[model samples]
Target: MIKKLIILAIIVVIAVFIRNSPYSEYLTFSYLEENSDALLAYVSDNRYISIISYVFVYIVVAGLNLPGAAVMSLSGGFLFGAGFGTAFAVTGATLGACIGFLVSRYLLGDVLNTKYEKQLAKFNKELAVNGYLYMLTLRLIPIFPFFVINIVAGLTKLRLFTFFWTSFIGMLPGGFVYVYAGSRLSNIESPKDIFSPGMISAFILFGLLMLVPVVYKKVKGRV
Candidate 1:
């Protein structure tokens, strides 16, 4: 545990420094839009470099708890097309989430558990019993930030493999939706364009599609 904390401290320090650096600006949607052509060309010309770059960027974004991950997901689609982009997004996101979860768990989970043992008991119980369900719900609806979700989940008793695989599977539908939309880049002006009213409504509809199972389970339990 001490070793984990030391490693986590190093990661946090590095993440903080990177977040405050100029390169952080390049993580935004505007930067992505302005350099879309160049980014695409570069990725195409150097596939291996692109993979490493995406992994690094994704890890940093997750580690720092940044907010442009949706844009990055879309950008992946624009750069690599739907199939490869979805694959890239899922792998990178799962890896990033693992890194965030590890750091959060290593650095803070023990402290939180010790400080709020009684309060956290119920949560820990729920996580242990229904970990997969909770992860699926979050991945499907994304009612919270992915990195934040990962960090919070780390505070619970969810197994590492459970967290990893559930996050990967859960995020798939939305990842595919966004990436598919990105592949049809003609209508896209900016990342903002991706979240137009229609698209939001569609996302809501999709969320409802996912919520059906949850609602059914609730109703059945009540019966």
Candidate 2:
């Protein structure tokens, strides 16, 4: 437990250090906007390198809870266009989310949860049973903080594969939405400009619709 805390602390320190360093400048929205044309040209000249770097940075940002992933996803769309952007963003986000999940489980699960293992036995059992569905609902909805979902999920006994896959699929709608908006980068001023009220409603409706089957199963079981 002590070792896990130490390791987690080390990871946080490393992440914070990198974010506060010179690399932080490029991660900003204003900087990206200021150099949009130059960035596009650079991507054109070094397509593969740019793509690799974008994906890697995205993973690291998300894993470390650094700022600007949403903006970065938008930038990816602007640079690579929607299809490639969504693919790369989703892949990196999923991988990064898993990293956060693992960290949470290591720091919170093994130590804290273990302390209350007996007390939490029943809740953990329920989580193990329907954790995927629960996570899916959270993923589909944008109301909650994405990082919070990852870390909270980690504090449970949900299987890593289940967390990874469910998060990947669940986040698809929202992720694609952001990446698609990035496709129209020239027309956008900020990341917040991407999501409109109509879009938020649509996301909520879709999320609820996805819940139908689970609700139906439960109702059927009750009957």
Best by TM-score: 2
Candidate lDDT scores, in order, read 0.77, 0.83
Lowest summed lDDT over 10 consecutive residues: which window, candidate 2? 122-131
Model 2 spans > 4 angstroms off: 114-131
- Cα error, candidate 2, residue 123 (Å): 5.4
- Stretches of candidate 1 off by over 4 Å are 1-5, 128-131, 196-202
- lDDT digits (tens) for residues 7-117 of candidate 1: 778877887787788977887777877888898889879999897788678766765677667777887788888998888887888888898788667788888768877
- Superposition error at 18 for model 1 (Å): 1.3
